[model samples]
Target: MAEAGEGRYEIASVISRSFETVRSNLGLFAGLALILSGVPAFALNLWQTSFGVNLNAAQPDFSALLSAAYLGPLFVGWLVAMVTNAVLQASLTRATVTHLSGEKPVFAQCLTVGVSMILPMIGIGILLALGVGLAMLLLIVPGIILWLCWSVVVPVYVQEKVGVIEAFGRSMALTEGSRWRIFLTMLLVLVGLWLLSIPVGLLTVAVAATGSVIAVSLVTAIVSALGSMVMVTVQSCVYVELRNVKEGVAPADLEAIFA
Candidate 1:
C-alpha cells in the first residue's frame, strides 16, 4: 500500500509538470480539434440516409447503418486526434521556448508538424485500438497497461522528433517508471470527460425533442471535441515535462527546432 501510494505521488508530480507545458499553449488545440471533428461531423451529415439517423429512434435500421458507418471519417477521428497532439506538442514546444527564451514561433511552423505526422498518427490509432482490444480480451488490466504506454507516443514523436517505432519506444520507456500512475491519470481524464458530458448530452436531447437532432449532435460533437482538445493538451504538456526531466533539454532548444 505504501509503495502504491508513493507511486501515485510520483505520477501526479510528473503530470503536474506536464500540465505546466500544456497551459502555455492551450490555444493551438482549438482549431485542430474543431477541424478534425468538423470534417467527420460533416461527412456523417453528407451520408444521412444510412448513418445519420439516431439508433434509439423507433424505426432505426441499426445493423446496416452500423456496418456502413464503421469505415467513415468518424473512425478517422482518432487519427485526427493523434495528429492534433503532434500539432499541439509542436505548439507547446514553441510556446515553451518563447516563455523560457523570448523566441516566438509562427503558425505555419505549427501546421507543418501536424501535417507531417499523418501516418504515425493513424498508426497510433490502430495500435491504441489493438491495445485496448487485447486488454479487454485479457481481463482489462493488460489493455490499460498498453494504453498508458502508448498514450504519450505522440509527444515523443513531436518533442523527440522520432519515427513511429521510436516514439513508441520513448513512450514505453517513460511508462517504465510508473505504469499505474499513468493509468490512474488517464482513467481520471476519461471518466471526468464522460461525467461532464452527461449534462451537455442531456441538454442536446432536450433540444432535439423540439427539432433538429443533427444540430443537437453537432453541439454534442463540439463538446466532445473540446474534451478531446483538453485531453491532448494535458497529454502534450505532460510529454514536455517528461522529456525535459528525461533528456535535460531545455524547452527553448526544442522550440528552436520544432517551432
Candidate 2:
C-alpha cells in the first residue's frame, strides 16, 4: 500500500500520461475509434441527414421526424451504437492498461477482451446512468458528487474482474480522498474537448447548410471518434493513477491481473 503522504496523484501527470499514451499508440487507438465509433456515428448521421430535416430552420418538421421511417432506423442505429461504444470502452481500457504496464497492446487481445466484457459493461452503464440521472433529478450537486465518485467504475471492473456493485464500491473507495482532484481533472478535459469542437461544430453547421449530408456526417463522425478516444484514454489513466496513489500498485503489477 502507499505510505502516508508518499504518493500524491497529480492532475497534470494524468493528463500528460493520457496524451502520451494516445500519441504513442495513435494508429491503434485511432483505428479502434474509427471502426467502433466513427462508422456507426457516420451511418446514423447520414441516415438522419438524408431525411432532410432542417434543424436550423425557424420551425422544423416534427411530423416527418416522428414518422415510422425516421424513428425505426434511428432506434436501431442507436442500439447498435450503444453496443459498439461499450465494446470500444472495454477495448480502449484494455489497451491503456497494457500500455501502462510497459507492454505493447495487441489489437486482437484488446478486441477479444472488449467483446467478452460487452454485456457486463452495458449493464453497468445502464445502472450508472439511471443512478446518476435520478440523483440529478434530486439535486445537481448530488449528481455531480455521484458522478465523481463513480468515475472510475469502468476501469475498476475491467482491471479487477469485480461484480457490478463491488466495482462501484471500489471506485468510491479509490476516489474517497481525491474526488475533488478527479472532478477538476475531468472538468478540464471536458472543457478542452468542448473548445476543440467549436471549429468542427462551425464547419458542420456550414456543411449542413450547403445540403451536403456526406460531408457533414464525415466531419461529425471524425470529431466524435477522436473525442471518444481521448476521453477513454484519460479515464484509464485516471484509474491507473488512482491505484498508484492509493494502493501503491504499479502498472506492471496490474498486468499480473491479466496473467
Question: Model 1: per-residue lDDT, tens digit, 1-259?
Answer: 2222222224565556445544554565456556665455544544452355566789876675567355565556555555555454455443443444344444566567566666666676667677779787988777777777777786777666778788888898765665665667667777877898889878877877878756665776677666766676656655654555555555557666664
lDDT of each: 0.61, 0.91
Model 2 worst lDDT run, 10 consecutive residues: 1-10
Residues 117-223, model 2: lDDT tens digits: 99999998898999999999999999999998899999989989999899999998998888888889999999999998998889888987997779989999999
Q: What's model 1's overall lDDT?
A: 0.61
Question: How does each model score on TM-score?
Answer: 0.73, 0.94
Looking at candidate 1, the ten consecutive residues that score lowest on lDDT are 1-10
> What is candidate 2's local distance difference test score?
0.91
Top model by TM-score, which number? 2
Task: Give the distance in Å from residue 208's predicted Cα in candidate 1 to where it truly belongs.
Answer: 0.8
Q: Which sections of candidate 2 miss by over 4 Å?
A: 1-6
RMSD to true structure for each model, in Å: 4.8, 2.0
